[model samples]
Target: MHWIKTLKYYLKSLGPGFIIASVVLGPGSITVSSRIGSEHGYAFLWVILLAAISMVIYTSMGSRFGVSNKDSILQSIAGNYGRWFSAVIGIAAFLAASSFQFGNNLGVGIAMEGITGVDERVWPLIFTPLAIVLLFWAKNLYKLLEKLMMVLVMVMIVAFFFNLVLTKPDVGEIAKGFVPSSFSFDSLDIIAALVGTTFVLHGALYQSYLAQKRGWKVGDIKKGLSDSYTGISLLALISVLIIITSASALYPNGITVNSAADMALQLEALFGSYAKVIFSIGLCSAAFSSLMVNAVMGGGLLADGLGLGSTMDEKMPKIFTTIALLMGMLIAVFFRGNIIYTLILAQASSILAVPLIAIGMFLILNNKKVMGKLKNNLWQNVLAVFGFLLISIMVYFMYGKIITYIQSLS
Candidate 1:
């Protein structure tokens, strides 16, 4: 009975972290990791490890900020910096989320088409209304979302792990891939996208808002940290599994994956039809989870910025979230060309907001007036400085790639 109670308590504590995990493992993750494995054959696997570590550090900071202060992150920024700064962050985050939503909706469509043999474009029409109903009518929106995301995470884990086992990747090469073997300029764009998607600005900032929604106090700081670690660890593990499955099944056969569907086709060739179906199931879970949460993040932040309420129960946030969902579905249904390029472009555009958000988070967390005793220590500050520099470098590379892509188009 004691063990059962403990298990229930632990599951209750996992709400925010698992939601973050679900958001991180979107269709963007599948596309990037699959392409990395198929094109570079696990040589770039180290990037996921780096991204995971960076995510843990920043997410922990966000968790601490949530527990240590009563104000929302944007409110804190407004108090410290100006309201304009807060508004900019909020608007930028909303726009970035909107841009990524195109891919999320596209992912949902692709998964549905693959699994049901229906037209890919029809999925956006079906799922968008379903998502809206859940967002509006779910009595306890946060708990309902947490529960739904938890189930999806489990589905993705089991499906990917099953496929990973079937792939039977070379254990020795997998071990070696962990080491930073070599770097390729061609891989830089995907690397940035991986980092951008994994260590998401909105996702990290929303950690504070989520913790508050869960009613976590400063006393729960340790628990919040544990939850963050657990979520990010799962994210890294699932990502590695994806790369392993793709590397083993596609690389050896010279299969080039241009989309998630391409990856599914390649997996079918290697492990028969069941593998493709399972992978598509995983893809659907990822896409749907992200589609829901991405809209919430965009709409919630924009409402908060506009001096309306930030929580999902508020009128403005719900309206804006619905708008985001519809916008994404429209794009996914109508704009059918060069989605991979669009995904990369949207992911890259998000880098413009990262440094600003990261720097703001660092400043707010370190503000003794805000965090008081919970303010970052010297080592934390050092690591955050390092993270800022890392984001700067990524931004440079991402800008170069976008320009190169544009020149090619012209």
Candidate 2:
């Protein structure tokens, strides 16, 4: 009974971190991690650890800000910098979410097509409306989202772990994957995508807003930190499991996964039809979970940017959320064949917003006026600097890749 009470208390404190984890573990992460595992085996596994550490640091900062203040991070920016700075951050966050929606919709379509044999394009049309309904009509939006994301996280963990067990991966290779190694051009691209997807700026910013929605206060700082750690650690674990599964199952066979369907086929070949179904379910959960959260982030932030209400219940935000979803679905439908490139491009584009958001949050968090005793300590400041440099490196590589892609197109 005592343990049960403790469990209930723990569960009550967890919300924002899981939301960030769910959004980060979306279709983009699945597809990229699977592709990396299939192509490079465990060679780049170190990247996941690096990305997870960065996630914990930045997300903790966001959570601290949320608990330290009564206002949203956007409002804090407005107070410290200027309204224009806040607006820019909000708008940029919205655009980044919109870009990510493309991958989210494509992932949903692929998972549906893989499962039901319907046209992939049709699935997006069906799922988008369902997402809209959940966003606008749910009785308690925050509770619903929290429960839903927790379930999805569980589904991903079990499904991927089952597949990993079946793969019977080499223990020695798995151990070596944790060791840092040199990278090739292609590996560098995958690394950038991994960083972009895992340590998401919008997801980081949304953490503060989410904590506020969950009614956390300065007294709850320790709980918030625990939630952030639990969420990102789960994220890193699931990611590594996917890579291990793919490495054991696909890498050994020289099977390159260009789409979720390709991953399904390979899983079928390695672990029978049941594995394929499980992987598809996990993929759909990932895609759908991300679809809803990304829309919320994009719409909510856009609403805030335009001086509309920032909360999820606001009509303007809901409207913009729908627009973000529809725009992503349209892109996914028209450009189905290029989804691999589309996912990569979308993840890369997120680099544009990372430094801006990170720097703003850093400044705001360090401001004694805003944060009081919670103002970043020396170690937190050091980590923030490291996070900034990490974002800069990702941006540099992403820029080079995008330019190369454009030149190839021309």
Candidate 3:
């Protein structure tokens, strides 16, 4: 009976946390992790570990908004802040997220070329259409995309371990990266990149809606917590492996790459030409996982903003999915170079938005009319406040840099 109950819980927890974890596997993460390894080797591994732990805690806060309120974050925003504000957020989020689709599409194409020994230019034409078809066939339903993400997870984990075997890293140096060291501005840009890579915006925002759609009530807090922990743990595991493999082989040779293809080349330098094949396999899975999750998120945001409920008729789902697929394809075709710049800018924008969302959710959850007995406890409020302030400061730093850059351009 106990085993049966556990199995049931796993099935129940599937769609929400899994999708969130899937988005975390995007090009932002793969490139940044690879860069970390190539530059400082194992010295930067602690950043990934810290970000993974922070993600688990923050993801819980966002997910609880749905479990307790029975509303998606966007829905709640629309109800309290009015449609204008929601529209502003929706537009901003869509544009930012669309840029990511382009980045991932490009990343996937590059990864394929490395493995197949083909020209990079040919891959974008092949992958964009295929991804559109895959997404179109799914109808953008969260449950279906969630399942696809799970399959990608299996493929990626297998590829990760295989790459680790090819690298055969020194465990001692890997251990040393965990010790907290003093900050240096030379590495600050890298640190910022890692932070942005780990804290994905669409994943966090979509999680609340996913939980509500899955019928997770405030009573299921313990179950939701378990699911979040599991999701973040998987992310941490992959992050560690990427860093380990790259640092062990690429760093000593001073080979730094800005994309997944570059990382694949570095891997080949270490293990052999076959190493590129293994990297390509893992990269494809990572990009696919992110693409699937983000497509669903974009559709859900549009539908919910238009006042659609959790249960839509068959036609509505198809419409939303088609719109999302088209948008993703358009972005992919137009997205050119500047992968690092795009990621950094998107993350900085998200950090600016998080504080407002956090504070609003806290107020709503505490409202007696809304949550009643489901109001936040002292600890929950404490966590939310801390997240709010932490993001606010990060945003300030990031925004300052943007302003400086603009001023210089002028």
Q: Provide the clash count, candidate 2.
A: 0
Query: In candidate 3, what are the lDDT values of residues 73-131, reduced to their tens digit?
Result: 76777888786655555554454455456556666667777777686556656765665
lDDT of 2 by residue, 1-410 (tens): 99999999998788778888888888888888888889889988898888888889889988998887888888878877898888888888888888788889888988888788898889888999899889889988888999999999889889889889999999999999989874676566777887876888778888888888878899999999999999999889988998888888899789998866788889998778998899999999889999998899888987876677788877898898889988988888787357687686777667776688888888998899999998899998988788788888888878877778768777
Candidate 2 clash pair list: none
Error of 3 at 70 (Å): 3.7
lDDT of 3: 0.68
In model 1, pairs of residues that clash are none
lDDT of 1 by residue, 360-405 (tens): 8898988999999989999888878877776788888877777777
Error of 1 at 129 (Å): 1.3
Task: List runs of model 2 lying over 4 Å from the truth.
Answer: 184-186
Model 2 TM-score, all chains together: 0.96
lDDT of 2 at 221: 92
Per-candidate count of clashing residue pairs (backbone under 3 Å)? 0, 0, 0
RMSD of each: 1.7, 1.5, 3.4
